[model samples]
Target: AGEAIITPADKKHPPTIPVTGAAVTIGVELGCAATPQSLQINGNLSNAVEGSVTPSIQGTGTVSGNGSGGSTGGQGGGSGSLSITPGLSATAADTVTTGGSLTGDIGPGTTRDFPIATKPLSGRDGYVVARETRVSVDGCLGGAQIRSYATAVISTPLGENSITTYGRTLFIDRDHPGAPPKLKPAK
Candidate 1:
């Protein structure tokens, strides 16, 4: 909210001053983006079980994204924060502004929504699983000219035990390309 004024004021005769000053609002645009991700398997099983499994896992390849952008603006001398200095004779703009959002369903990673692979095991037989994920956000800091708010919710519990007991992995090498052929049995 701003102020209004008049001059030569008496009980019955008051001067009429027109309203004035800069507009009270602004707007901006926003967007989202993503990148490529992949996985490779290596390593051999030691003391192999007397059973076998055939697996067929399909993956979604690399990805990218874009988003819309807008700005919060006012009718002023410059693009700095919006403020006013009250005095006898104040000057400003009467520009009215609206707001907009720059949003995209984008990130550094993508969901492999489709099931990758399945395996059937006999008694005392087990399998392995590996997961790698990265997340980030940009250009959303709160400032005098721009304010930002973000909320993140994770349904997955936090801990090693959050994973299914038997479907978990015993070892893996995310950076390494190949696994050695010989592995001593898991005592």
Candidate 2:
């Protein structure tokens, strides 16, 4: 969603030093319910980072309804976090970057963790600490199309002279006639 960097005041040069770190924790969860013709699902994912850099990520999603024939509805949401250490490999071109990816269902009472590959850089070597969270929900009412929503956030540290950027994606699906396609037309 959003991120901020804290710089050490003692550093002589700007806060633009390379660093290394690792994710020390990961967690995930899932929930589901079904009737004769209807069904409901929810899940979530969370992660923590330590070592050279520290960051965290979390998300939630759900899917439910009578796919065969009936009424139903669903909804979902999620977010992410990250942290970075400075001066591990101080260099003129030192820099730090972080990012992650998420898929599947995420919702309440659900969480999971994923391992990210560490990259080695010349001149300034730094670690990438990152995590991601996702959530979703879906359902249908009679012949009407059901609805679902999902959200995610990611954060990372940057060199004093560097900048960080973030983005997200959303998908939906329905089986009713006149139902919109899984991917909405770009605005």
Worst 10 residues of 2 by lDDT: 144-153
* lDDT, candidate 2, 44-74, per-residue tens: 4555433443444444545444324335654
lDDT for predicted candidate 1 compared with the true structure: 0.29
Whole-model lDDT per candidate: 0.29, 0.33
Q: Model 1: per-residue lDDT, tens digit, 51-164?
A: 334544444444444445458643333232434443343334444444454543332522222222233222222342323322233432221111111111112123111111
- Which regions in candidate 2 have their CA more than 4 angstroms from the true location? 1-111, 125-165, 172-187
**What is the Cα-based lDDT of residue 75 in candidate 1?**
37
Q: TM per model?
A: 0.14, 0.18
RMSD of 1: 51.2
Indicate the residue-level lDDT of 2 in model 2: 24
The candidate scoring highest on lDDT is 2
